[model samples]
Target: MSRQFRLPLHSPPSFAREHFAASPTNAQAIAAIDAWPRWGDGRLALIGAAGAGKTHLARDWALKANAVVVEAANPLAAPLDLAALRGRAVLVDDADRRAQGGHLDDETLFHLINMAGVDGGTLLLTGRLAPVAWDCAVPDLRSRLNALTAAIIDEPDDIVLEAVLRRAFAARAMTPAHDVYPYLLRRIPRSSLEAIAAVDLLDEAASAQGRAITRLLAGEVLAFEGDEGED
Candidate 1:
């Protein structure tokens, strides 16, 4: 059997406005978040490709609103204690994933939606696609999800990518040199998830080696056997 490698977990970063790199990609999504508590229908959905900053925005919004956030994909797994989420805005990340394994059925979601409506609480659902596109077997849940206000996150442009890289490094308390930025821009994958993974790997390498991040080190670490295929 192969050994399982466990990555180290670090403390959560202190999020700041500077860390959020606004771009045309997320302009509308950002605007909708700013206009909170006015989600008149009590339901809103954020649709985007993977690594498109959906989770980041959801976390940020949850912090700002002091709302009780729940991952709809792994919701309570038992009869939900509505009292726990009632009268408080809820943010459900990866809402589409729920339909994958029947983890979130029509009954559960309908109850949550009804609770939010009755309590005047907001419900924010995030997914890779609009509800209509999800493989939801329950007709009622599918219809309800499709009716929510939906917003899509555009892929980041070059400028936004650079800014995101810088912010991600800062979040790790790593001050990557300016020269390294251009190098990574040319070498790394455009997906935000890949970018974040690179930053994380760099952080671990730098810490293990007790040296500052440099181009040579980044290149070597990125080319290691298992990591070679990763951008």
Candidate 2:
């Protein structure tokens, strides 16, 4: 038996506004974001589960606000500076990861919160959960988190999830049989991220076997996924 060698394909996701698919699940969040400086405190917390399109929404806001984007998973590696951000927008993505207390630097986040609230900048903090649910040991930071106005994006519903799958497949120029879509929707989790991952796995499997993606291939990949999870 020979092992197949699949090259590492780089498919960078597009976070452009046109690429974002809106639905009832995220309508309010998008509306809130569009409302912008209309927010009382010029600060907001965008909350959603993994693969819930939080980054897409955040990037959309950034485009409109001309905001600088940073991951809470990796805050400023250099010295923090907020002098020039006066009355501007800043997006701190994955802001709830407490690995380093501030997405990687708690003290810096604490300061950013104060600056945005009391000073001039507009800050949008994104996380997997609401502020109340985030794990932060900083006493001062907790209070700031509580003060933020939050916009929550629920995980994708059936319609949105289907659109995500279709879009993901289209992006790769791959089309499964018409019935494959319903077959997949029934078996996979309802999430934008999950749809993308499922497509990737199926793509890899099809490429390895030199076959087009069909219902049978999807079932095989899904079965493998379940087996891996059980292990």
Q: Tell me the alpha-carbon RMSD of every candidate.
A: 5.2, 5.3
Q: Write the per-residue lDDT of candidate 1 for residues 94-118, one digit (tens) a residue.
A: 8778743444666767767666655
Most accurate candidate by TM-score: 2
Q: Which pairs in model 1 have colliding backbones? A: none
For model 2, residues 158-189, the per-residue Cα lDDT tens digits are: 77788888988887888888988877777677
Candidate 1 error regions (>4 Å): 1-9, 13-18, 75-78, 83-86, 99-103, 171-173, 206-212, 224-231
Local distance difference test, each candidate: 0.73, 0.76
* Candidate 2: 10-residue stretch with minimal lDDT: 1-10
| Candidate 2 residue runs with Cα over 4 Å from true position | 1-9, 98-104, 117-120, 224-231
* lDDT computed for candidate 2: 0.76
List TM-scores for all candidates, in order.
0.78, 0.85
